[model samples]
Target: MRPRSLDEFAGQEHVVGEGSVLRRALDAGEVPSLILWGPPGSGKTTLAQLLSAQVGAAFEPVSATSAGVADLRRAVERARVRSRSSDTRTVLFIDEIHRFNKTQQDAVLPQVENGVVTLIGATTENPSFEVNSALLSRSRVVRLEALGDMQISALLDRALADTDRGLGSRAVELEDAARRRLIELSGGDARVALNALELAVMATSDTNGSARVGPEDIEGALQQPALLYDRAGDQHYWLISAFIKSVRDSDPDAAVYWLARMLEAGEDPMFVARRMVILAAEDVGIADPQALAVAVAAQQAAHFVGMPEGYLPLTEAALYLAVAPKSNSALRAYAAARADVAATLNQPVPLHLRNAVTSMERAMQFGAGYRYAHDQEGGLIEQQHLPDGLTGRRYYEPTDHGAEAAIADRLRAMRGVSPRVSYRDTPRPMIGSKRPRGQAFGDRTLHFEPHVPLIGGRRPNTSRSCGAGSPIPR
Candidate 1:
């Protein structure tokens, strides 16, 4: 049953309760154009009607989905006429106001500005993103929270006992478990609970006089099942996090299930697809080079194909990523490089590495003796490109996982020589043992502070030096 008066309105005490701004405005009998933003069944429509009645204005309801610019013009004209004839203003309540395109929404501005009608718009989406800025600026956006369990239960109790507008005529009684199930399945949605309750009572034959409804009957009435997901609330973030984590953990089943849950909850499939793409780069990485490509392709397909068929590519990409070889080496490598850049800011480029573009630059030997690697045997030669004081610094550490293993081998060959020290093979330092002395090496020896705290700190017990014959320092 719809609430005819604010006193009978269930929940949303913050806005319509005693001494609230809206309540005070209602008392003043000069309510301003306002926007009610909340999830479905959060009493936006009912609130609009109650407010119109409170202000003693003619109520004109329009659905933005069906109403066009023409409808707005007609409503405004009617309001203007009513204002002149009866000296009564209109309160135009546009449901799903966000559905109105910018042009259509703009059509209501003049009337709203002139007070022909107090625009009471209702939206499930954020007004800032949906409603025109001009209209939004003139209205106070009041946020209504989803009805809690206790509130929904109280509403159900009222609906069951109220003979005037509820199912009291049928003399229906709901089992305790059935009531709890209804509340849970409704997901804090009042309309859903009421509709389900009405259906269950109507579907079941009254036993002698009172029809006894159980969870089974309630479940049957709710044909379109839904999880307790608030797209604009915290559950939205939690669900997406769970989905990404499932994909990262390489659990195809969990990933697919979460993806389905989000899709069913009306989450933008494109949003989910975009997250999968990030997961491909961050978690899957070069271990499966195709993962990123598949994720990007899925995102593009979702946009191009749109819903229903779009879900196929989205799900396929999720599954592909979940089963692909996982690696965070690329992410770690980049982080390391970034850390070095931050720590050693403004290090000068080595003379050999600088481009010898001008005569003076060539005289300063910016690119002197720069070897042409392609001209050398096997198109490889030993050369240091890092700036001075940072020679032999290593950032990208290829993992032994999947495709990276081959990359590691290729990288080792291109680099001319590998660090001979085995960090894992080194024994742990004994208590009270001395810090190991730096071993002798050629001019290529790269000394690093023993406690310099490198990014991820160079695999436990590893030596920091990156030249040949470097020992695994204790």
Candidate 2:
């Protein structure tokens, strides 16, 4: 069978073809140590083969699941011998590279640095966490996207008409119905489509060798065992991606479902909790500031109490996060400030804000003109804290998605910040007796999910439940 080259490489036109990143790199004849990141059947391994073939580099391949440090050492040794003998570097291709732990991954660094081999690692998992940071830095990551429906259909069309590798002019025939079924079942995986088509043909063939392929003949073929990861494998990370997206999407029920998936996968409860903690701070920032506290507390409590028992805290945390008024304003604030610091690393800190922690330091004109907020009874001292040239720059703009409505007003009044608040300055509270006037205490707050089943299953009195029809169970 003829191997597919760059000219024949289907899909990912963004990265391949003339004037593209890969094309340019291949033309240069020495591409960076690369990590191809994508879903299965997105041609990660194929790309590796293509890379080696195009560049005239001998490819040495290893499977991460089966290859140990010993196997790695031998590959390294072989590469060394080949490089010295041919005076040409080899491409050490490692598939499922995330399976290699830190120590094994560390061994490849020196080889990569020495140019004895160009490390071409393939992993479905995000390299930032799975691959060692140093090794990742040495490689340029190329992300492959799942083929769209159009691409999948086009591939199927080619398979149906091509007589060589594909089953064109075969004893079996593929109807449009059969084609649609094949494409749908492939889940954008090319290997899956080819394998399924092959299976359906075999199933339809008679003892005398006459066969016909149709929707009926391929029904069982649809259920054929996967050619790829049987269990979730690294694809389980994709579930976490879905979960994070759901949480970000703000559908509590959907978030709960993703949590259930991660939990069932035996994903570390603490790790899940940690992400929740991060999400609470990163996604549900000052708009629902209490969520970060709740998430962090749940993580600590779950850790301290230790599982089965720990699940309650986790569940509660998820629920709180799901229902919390979501905001990324605080996250944006920090990011903006960090960007400013990075852009102006050499800019001097204004003198007034500098520490007067020592008398000698104080004598060096430190803390000369600082205004203390505490000195004012209201804790409302108006003073500039930014660099002299960078004053009145607004970094945090609050959205009224949740608690931010009130926060939007308060900060607007306090800092002269003009915010595009999405909701009214004062939204009616759930426990609305006009919000019990004067100095609200933080203690004894009532909270509940709107769609959650009422406590003890009691539908409230129609007229007496505070002008509300249903007494939502707390």
lDDT of each: 0.81, 0.73
Clashes of each: 0, 1
TM per candidate: 0.67, 0.56
Candidate 2 lDDT over 61-146, as tens digits, reads 99999999999889989988887898766899999999999999998999898888899999888888789999999999889887
- Candidates in order: C-alpha RMSD to true structure: 10.5, 14.1
For candidate 1, lDDT tens digit of each residue in 298-345? 999999999878899999999999999899877776765565565556
Indicate which candidate wins on TM-score: 1
What TM-score does structure 2 among the candidates reach?
Answer: 0.56
**Which one wins on lDDT?**
1
Task: Output the worst ten-in-a-row residue range by lDDT, candidate 1.
Answer: 422-431
Model 1, runs deviating above 4 Å: 207-209, 226-242, 245-257, 263-274, 283-368, 371-447, 450-474
In candidate 1, list every pair of residues with a backbone clash. none
RMSD of 2: 14.1
**Candidate 1 residue-wise lDDT at 230:** 72
